[model samples]
Target: MTSTVRRAGAFAILSTLSLVVPLFDPVTAVPVAAAVLLAAFAVTDGPLFDLFAYPDDYEDGRLYGLITFVLAATALGLVSVMSSMSTAVFVGTVVLVGYGNLAAAVTREWTDNPASHAAAFCVGATTAGVAGHAISRTLTGDPVTDTFPKIVFLAVAGALLAALLRDILILYDDPVVMLAVGFLCWLLAELVPGLGATEIAVATVVTVAVGYLSYALGAASVAGMLTGILLGLLTIVLGGYSWFAVLMSFFAIGSLSTKFRYDEKVDRGVAQENDGARGSSNVLGNAAVALVAVLGYAASAADLPLLGEANPELFLFAFAGSLATAMSDTLSSEVGGVFDTPRLITTLEPVEPGTDGGVTWQGEVAGLLGASVVAGLTYAVFPDVGLVGAAIVVTAGFVGMTVDSLLGATIEGTAVGNQGVNFLATLSGAITGALLVLAVAVL
Candidate 1:
């Protein structure tokens, strides 16, 4: 087909997809987009923008885009295959995972060897998560639920039109790219281990709501997209689940504690919110452990060993524990940021909110109370957990808070390539809590 015809065809297909993908879930559409992007990249040179519009004029842009497309596809494809993953094994997995990892690598300013490592880690970790979540969810007949792909594409299309009409610089921070990344991340989380449909739904709601609120509040430039995603998820938790209510309460105490010389952290705008999302260590760390636990359950219940049915109770218990830890840590930073007064977590010295080892009086007190509330309320979701499990959930929050602070102070966001302390901290807390209960049973 002629170039004009091909481009026209692509646009037509994309338009059709824009309409249909939403109904089936955007994650499913991601793969096809990725494939098309790859083909476009193959035909281009270096930069991404130039590739779609004028590849001949920008060979460098076309070439770079091609490289990225190939590498992303290759990396995600291999990881998915290696894990023998189920949920994300489909084409959608390749597209979303590729897009997500590519964004992370791109944002990290990865180049040469570091680029490969970033790709490897991002794709491998993501695949592991998908494999783990799928194993358990499928076993229990629960499916991953989300529609971010369509939301992102439509947002991008809208953004592109606005940029074209305004004749402004529609440069790097393209809405389309962000939408793609966000949608991809949503899919990854759906298939993530220690994750569930409930969490996915909560995240989607939070992102949309917060995005709208930020716009209403006039945080248009900074809050319109990504911030909205974060807030949307938060809203879902606060609005839909009692688990978040308690956690938010505890975080409020933690933030307030800093004012009374409890913990000091000089609070700011961006750091106040993103420190948790970008810096959390528990995300990937605990996911690995959850995979094992859920897989074991899946193997047992299905009577097919590796393909066994999942015991819903055990899976729910695991999911709640994981969600509890993540929410607890996130709420801590958010609530803590509400207060101006902050203290050092290590020595009770006053420090910046962005500073590691810093705490706040209001944040700490509120954080704890919040955690206890989440633990208790989350337990109510699954009768299998009983009251004892409730204690474990609350305890995990405390543990997660301590681990997150300690690591942040001592290692997080500061280490050379050890950028996962927060994720690890949360993971540590959840797995520790889960294992503690499991160990108690053994004894």
Candidate 2:
């Protein structure tokens, strides 16, 4: 057998261990699984290592993958024991991870075509969804239709996410992929119960269509497109179409700003890499915080009260603030790079156009405009927020953009990369917006 086939077969067999979880109590199952993994790890460096090792795996990579797979199963088991409704979800996650890996491995060995590999992964995930549902029905004596749509949705989403993660992470991609798929399946199973079939169908269709269009237009790479689709689906389903519109508004603004003076920016060495085509890092840096806000909004709507009282308003403000900050920063960098000479934000010393912490009047103005556009759309979509909430978003955006510049000047190059700064800026924007809303409420 090829090394790929060996790896795939090993994964499938190991994943099947999850099936025995129901026989043991959850508490015992976790420790037993952990012990087994520990034993395997201990022996990995010994003479028996080749039995479980793949030829292409880095030192201990195969063991790491096994550990992650076990962790995923453990998480699912815990969720299953805690909630009666989640048992099937847990089973579905295991099946999807196992089947998806198996299929992807076989496809990789058969052909070098990226599209074919992706198709195989999705097919495996979908098949797992159906088979898992059947197994769950047999075990729990539940009807076949119970949570069927949700299982399928989670499976496909997990597959796409795994594929995206595989592209981005080089060292521990397989492990991360498995862990991510498991978490996604768990999360969606809990949250998606409230959504109707039509709503889910709509979100999926819109997200896929938009993702494809963005890729086709060269605004996003394959990984970026996948990240966008996943984030877009969650946003629309949890926060509503209006929320998704706001996200798209940010994307549109950012894309346009990047293209505004493409040749000039390129000539000046300030252009985004790959002709401004965004990748997974760019998408996640700008939108991960926003996605968190969407999750908060969903939890609020569901009245889970994970964070005190369910305050959808606060999350909404945070969501808008995050996007506003992202747009502001993007426009400031792109437009400011072209229009005016920049000065260091810290000392007012003349600096290169692309210098860290660089500031320009033209850029600041463009940033403000970008913030306002997002804030305005927030008001239009969610009129309940009123002018005060919109104002908070704008203020948060400006504050976050300034913070980005400050960080860029002081510690960006040494302490953190550009993406790290972007994440922090968006996080600060989210916090600022939330605090403002709370202050207004207190008053």
Candidate 3:
């Protein structure tokens, strides 16, 4: 058999193991099975490795895909056993991972078209969702109608995420897709019970429209559009459209800033690459922290342990702060690069406009303006967030901008990339926003 056929067959056969999960104690059986698989794969010359591994696996001297799959399965098993997640959901995730990959592999062998691979994976995801729903209904005796919508939503989300990750990531795509799908299932079960068909439909329509509009505006590339859609859906579903608007505000301000003095920036060789069409990295670096804060706020609403104990409002503030920081940093770098002769932030020495860690008064003022815009939006969106909260967000944004400059001056190029500094700066802004909220409460 061809290597592709062998891989597909192996995935199909191994995925069936999920069917027997209900018969065994997942807590014990999962660990023992995982241990055995690890041992088997550890043997380089083993039949299991030879049969299941890919060409890249030989180059890496290990079965990376299989190892990731095993790890993902083990994680799902542990979550199922510990949480209120049903065994059927775990089975569904495993099937989705395996069958989805199998379908992709087979489709790839036939044709190299990306759209075809995505369609095939979606089919596999839908099949897994149906299987999971049937098993849940059969085992739990729940009304079929009760879980159908959520399961269907999960399937659709899994398909989108799988397609995006498969297209973007060079490795570990399957495991990440599995974990994301599993998390979505868990969220549906535990946190967002109100997310029925209507909410899903609305979220999809709004996100897709916004994503397309952004792409048309040349603010985002194809990958950026997909990432934005996913993140936009999560923000709307977890928080609300108002929160999503906050994110859009950042995107609008950043995009406009990049376009400001576009010709001059290009002449100086400081313009954003691809005329400021954001890719996946740019989207994730700027917005991931804000997304995490939205998730945290959702968890707080659901009263999930440590995250729950904190005031949910704190997360909202953090969300604003993160976005504010992103806008500030973008404006400072993009707008400042065109207008001012910059000085190094660490030392008072003149530097090129595009130089890392460069600072100019024009940039600082623009950064503050960017922060103020987001903070004003925050105050407008949430009535409870008074002037004090808005001021805190602005302060946090400025602090994050300073942090970014400091990091750029010190360790950015040597130890961490630009994205890492952006992430850290946003994280700092988030923490600052949250802490200031707490301080106000304490005082």
Candidate 4:
């Protein structure tokens, strides 16, 4: 085979050998791990710095050789002065960077191809998993049961999802941004209480299963599936299974409605691409408001004193309102388009089907029905809120739907895409719900 392939194989073998050393002789594993990692760096001819250069740009290996030599010498020099923890951190950094270099070198050829990028992603994921587990082992002596390991698992899993999806989703245009989003989502999930080995395992399994199911059903693209996994896990873990049921109902209603007049929508040139399968932006736009509410609710439950006494009522209202708005807007557009011609919300004049800001009596009525479903379910969760709270949810949802139409007709495509419109509408619904509850409490 080629020289690079041979070098990669050698490096992989060294890494594997280093990992197995712990099984044979635990005491010497540390020094041996350090040696193997540094040797892998040398064997690969310094893959790390090479990543900084263009893939086509060739460099003399001797320069990298000198740099590696200098770096190794410096690391050795610091060993005398560094504390145990400092030395461990330094070594860990070196190992991670070495693995990263290998991944970058191997995937350089397939940088532009989504499917081919998996090789590089696998390398990165393995590195992250190993480092995270090692840290957990150091701290708790049990990687499987510890806190940090679960966080690492979630982070790496989300990263893998993002890497597989970034090319297909406009929301994740930048790799850094996509990775940051995954990190943040995991961070929030970590803050939830009672997330130990069992919860983490359950969340992982459910995320994977839901992701696969959504993809298989053609309800979502790969990006949307990734987004769904993150959102669904948070909803289930923090909001309870009943709330998750309500969440799924919204997705079910939206997806089925989109398919009601799929062929006609395509003919009209107003149909969503990929047979109305949603993307990352669509998923985030619809669910992000509810996610915020989930985070707030969890924070309240965690009893963070700074939050000034957890307002559970406001949290419930926000969550219900967001779902209600999303369902209402979706049904209004999809189902309304199926029946009657629409009139511009801002004007008395009739407009063609699928026109922005267009609405019909049939569509508005259908939207109310959609909103009612969410309100009813939400009330079922909080029966103490009574029928008035449900009424408030439906009204706020309808108001948000109205705002969506108004924005769409006025300045949707110019200043914001459909996703942006949806997000704002959901936010509006949430705010309205929170305000109404506060008003009732004050009076």
Query: Please, what is the whole-model Cα lDDT of each candidate in the order they appear?
Result: 0.44, 0.80, 0.80, 0.65
Per-residue lDDT value at 23 in model 2: 41
lDDT of 4 by residue, 1-443 (tens): 44444443444333333233223333454566456446434543455434322232245433333233234423432441242322222223233323433564467554664334543643564465447336534543344344554444444454544454544544212323333433444345445564566666676677667666877788987677767777777777777776687787788888888888789878877777889888788988999999898878877877766566979779888888888999999999987786557899999589988889999998899899999999998788766868989998998899889998999899899999999999999999999999999988888
Off by over 4 Å in 2: 13-17, 22-52, 56-85, 109-116, 171-173
The full ranking of all candidates by TM-score, starting with the best, is 2, 3, 4, 1
Off by over 4 Å in 1: 1-57, 60-315, 334-343, 348-354, 416-419
What is the Cα-based TM-score of model 1? 0.47
User: How many steric clashes does model 4 contain?
Assistant: 0
Tens digit of per-residue lDDT, candidate 3, span 274-387: 878888889899999999999888889889885647788889989999999999999989878986679999996999888889988999999999999999998998888999
Where is model 3 more than 4 Å wrong at Cα?
Answer: 1-17, 23-53, 57-75, 82-84, 102-127, 130-134, 171-173, 176-188, 212-218
Question: What tens digits encode model 1's per-residue C-alpha lDDT throughout 6-58?
Answer: 43233323323322232344355557656766666566433334324423436
lDDT preference between candidates 1 and 4, better one: 4
Alpha carbon deviation, residue 396, candidate 4 (Å): 1.7
How many clashes in each structure?
Answer: 66, 0, 0, 0
